[model samples]
Target: MKKNVFYVLMLFFVFTACNREDMQNNPGNIEVVQKDPLTAKEINEKINETIKTKGRFSWKESSDHFIWSTIFQGNKIASIGFGSSFDRNLDSNNKAIEAEILKVIEQYEGKTERILLSSDQYLNQIDVAIEKQETVIALRKMKNIRYLEPADYRYFENEQKLGKSSSGSSGCGFESTALSASDYTTVTPNAKAPWSFTKHNIINAWSYSSGAGVTIGVIDSGVSPEQTLLGSSFNNGLSSGRTISKNGVYVDSIWPWSTGYDGPNDQCGHGTSMASAAAAPRNNQGQPVGVAYNSNLVTYRAASNVVLDGYHEQNGVKIAFTELGNNNNVKIISMSMGHIFSVGKIEDGVKYAYSKGKLIFCAGGTSTSFTNFVGVIFPAWMSETQAITGVKENTSNQKCDVCHSGAEIDFTYQMERASGNSIPVLSYYNGQTDYVGGSSVATASTAGIAALVWSKNPTWTRDQVLNKMRQSATYYPTPNSDYGYGNINVLQAVQ
Candidate 1:
C-alpha cells in the first residue's frame, strides 16, 4: 500500500512541474508574455506557425522596408492588397487560427508597431482569440519608419500658388547660359561644352556620371529621326564622335512602333524633355548641361497611344533589360513613367537592375489628381532612403544639397508658361517638342548626375555612388515634406 502511495505522489509532482513550465512560457496566452514590440523573432514564429497550419506559403523579408512579401498555398494571396494594407485574408486551419489569435493580441494590446506576420498565423491568432473571448485588433498598423504617403505633399500645391519665387528657378541654380553654337571653338566658363566642363572643372573628388560609358536604353513613344537635340545624336554620331551601335541597331529599328520612332521628335514633348534632361549632348557653349552627355543611349518606342491612356510599361521594361543585359556599357537606367495605386512590380524590376550592378533613377510623382492636393507616385517611392536629396539654399544664397529639407525649394526650377497650358522648347524633340516640368524631370536629372559619377570612377559600387552623392549633398534648414534630402549639386559631387 505504501509503495502505491509513493507512486501516486511521483505522478502528482510531474504534473505540477509540467504546469509550472506552461505558466512560465505562457505560449497559449501570448498577451501575458508579449511585453515588447513585435520583433523579427516573434514575426518569424508567427509565420512558421501559419505555414504549418496552411500547408504552404512563400515569404521574404526586406531589411530596407521591413515588410514581408508572402504568397499562400497554391499561389493564393492570403492577404489583401498584396502588401501593407489594412485588409487581409487567412487560411481557416488550426495553426492559422492560432497565429491569427496571437497577431490580434499583439496588435491590440502589445504595441503600436506593425509586425508583418504570415496570413495563416494572423488568421489563426485571431480565431484563437475569438474562441477565448478576447477580441481586440487595431486597424491601423504600420512600421516605425517614415513612409511617403499620398497626403504628404498637399502643402506644396498651396506653396506653389502662394507666388513665392524660389532661387532654384529654371535656368538659374547650377546652370550656365545656353551654349552659342557658332562659338564652339572659343571655350568660355559657360561656353565650354557640358561634358568637358564637368570632366575638367566640376569633377575632382566626386562623379555624377554613373551612366558614363553605359548604354541608357530609352523606351518611349518613339525617338525622332531628324531631330538634332534628343536621340538624333545616336543616329548622326556627332556628339560622342563614335557610331552609336556597331551593328547599326540604333540607326535602324523595325519594331511595330518604328513608324512612330522619331528619335528626337517630342510629339507629346514629354519624352523629349525627359531625354534632354537625361542625356542631351554637351553644348560646347551653353549653360549648365545634362548630367551625362557622353554616355551611350538606346532608344525604343514604348508609348503606344496617349489619348487612350495606354502606355507600354511592361514592354519598356522588357526591352530595356533585354537590350541592356549583355551590353557592358549599360550601367544605369532612368525612368519617368508610373501610376499611383500600383502593386510595386516596377520596383521589383528596379531591384533586378540593381542586383546586376546597374543604377536606376526614377521620378517621384506629380500632382495631377483633381481631388487630393498631395500624393505620391510610383518609381520614386521605390528608391532607397538616401537615393534622392532635395535642393536647398546655402548661407551664401547658393543651392545646397540636403536631405529631408523643405525650406530650400524657393528657387527650384519651373517652366515658364507661354500661353494656355503650352510652352516653348529651348531645344528639340521627336515631335514638335515643347517645354514641360514635373517630379519626373527632377528624377531624370538625378539619373543624369548618376551617369556622370559612373563615368568618373567606373569602379564604384552602386551603394558607394549613392552614399557619395548623399554625403556630398549640402543640407538645407527647416526641412519639410516637399524636398526630401535637399537640392542636387553636381559641382559638389565632383568636388
Candidate 2:
C-alpha cells in the first residue's frame, strides 16, 4: 500500500510540472481578461481628455496596454523601441534587444518563423506582430523595451472611413494662380520678388548672402518635374553654380512590409510651393523668386500630404531624416509636415539628424478640419527643431487665421497680406505661381533665411547662426508668451 501511494504522488508531481511549463510557454492559454476595443470617438475623447489634463499628449507617457487597445484596437503589429532613448551608438545593443523580443514573441505565439515586419537600420526601433495580449504585458515588463505603439494605426484614414469630415488642412493642391502686380516687385531677369520679401528685408539680405554655398534639405513632397526652374533649368539666370537633387523615400502602400518606393515626384501641390518659397531659381521667366534663390536644393517626397496621418507617411519621414542626416552636404533640414502628437520613430529620426549637427526647422500647427486645439504639434514641439508660424502683416503678436501659436513658437513670418493673400510661390507646374499660406510657407521661408545666414557665415556653428538670428529678431533678450523671439530681420540675421 505504501509503494502504491509513492507511485501516485510521483504522477501528480509530474503532471503539475508539465502544466506549469505549458502555461509559461503558451500565455494565450493562461485565461487573459480582455477589454473591448475602443471606438474612434472614444479614442478621440480620451486623447482630448489626456491633453486637457496633462497640457499635452505623448505616446511615451501612455501605458503600453492602453496604446494597444485604443490606438490599435488590439491590432497584431506593434512598434518596439528598445535600448536607451535617442542613443545613436546602440546599434549592436539594439540587435540583441531585437533577438530577445523575437524570443519572447516565439514563446507566446509558439512559432519560430520570422515575425518582424520591419527594423530600422539606424534607430533602435522595430515593427513586429504580437498575437497575444499576454505578449504585450510581458514586453512591457522587460527592462530594455522603452515603448510599444501601434505600427499601422492611421487616425485620419480611419476617421475618413468612419464618414468624418476631411481634415481642412490636407495640404494637397495642384492649382496655379496668376501673380498680382500689387503682390510683388520686379527684380532682375524679369523675376518677381514676393511682397513678404520686403517685409522681412530678404531682398536687402540678398546683398549679403543668397545662400550660395549652403544646401537646404526639404523633407516634404518632391519638387515638380514640370517646374524646370527646380529641375534642369535650376541654374538659370543669376541662380548659377548650384545643384538640385530629388529623392523619394515614401512608400505608397499601407502595409509595413511593402518595399516599393514611390518615385521622387510631388503628388501633392504643397511641396512644390514649399520648394519654390525656399529656393526656386532666379530666372528670366517672370516667375516668383524664392528666399534663397542661389542655394543648392535637395527635396524629398516623404509623405502623401502635409498632415502625417498614415503609417507610410510617418515611415517615409523617418527614412528621409536618417538619409539626410547621413548626407554630408545637407546643412539645413526643413519639414513643413507634422503630426498633432509625437510619433516615436519620427522623434528618433529628428534626434538622429540633430545629433549630426543639421539645423532643423518645422512648422507650428495649422488649423485642421478635425481639431485645432493642438499647440505646436510634434517634431516642432520638440526642442531639437526651430518652430515657425505665420503672422499677420507687420504684427508679431497676431497669428494668421489658420495658423497656430504658443510659447513654443520660435519665430514668425510675415506671410499673411492685408489683401487676404499669402506668400507667392512657383506653382507645381512650370511658368506658374501660386499662393500658399498658414505655417507651411512660414517654416519653409524661415529655412531659406537660415540658409542665407549660414551661407554668409559659412564657418559658424549651428548655435552661432541660431544665436545671431535670435539677437536680430524683433523681440530680443526677452520673448513674448505667445511668440518666442518674434519676426526675424533677414538682413540683420545675415550680417
Q: TM-scores, in order shown?
A: 0.47, 0.92
lDDT per residue for candidate 2 within 1-495, as digits (tens), equals 999999999999998888763454456555456555567666766776787677688776766556756535524677788887655475557777788878887887778765787888888888787666677766766778877877777666665666654755588888988878999999887889999999999999999999999999999988888988889998879999999999999998766667888989999988888999999888788899999999999899999889786678888999999999999999999999998778888988999999999999999978876656777888898999999999999899899988989989999999998899998888888877899999999999999999999999999999998999999898997988888899999999987
The digit string of per-residue lDDT tens for model 1 on 1-495 reads: 999999999999998887753431233432422222343344344433543564222222222121211111111111221223211232224444334434554444344333332222111111011111111112112221112111111122232344432322211111113333431222323322323223223333223332446556554444444445554344222246522321112212222122222232333445555566556555443322344666666554444311111112332343344344445667666655543333222333454455567666654444332212213344445543122322221221221221111222211222212221211222442223233344445556666666666666678887877665655444433333455434545666654
The numbered model that scores best in lDDT is 2
Q: Once model 1 is optimally superposed onto the true structure by TM-score, how far is the C-alpha of residue 336 displaced, in angstroms?
A: 1.1
**Weakest 10 consecutive residues of candidate 2 by summed lDDT:** 21-30
- lDDT of each prediction vs. the true structure? 0.38, 0.85
Which 10 residues in a row give candidate 1 its minimum summed lDDT?
68-77
Native-referenced Cα lDDT, model 2: 0.85
**TM-score, prediction 1:** 0.47
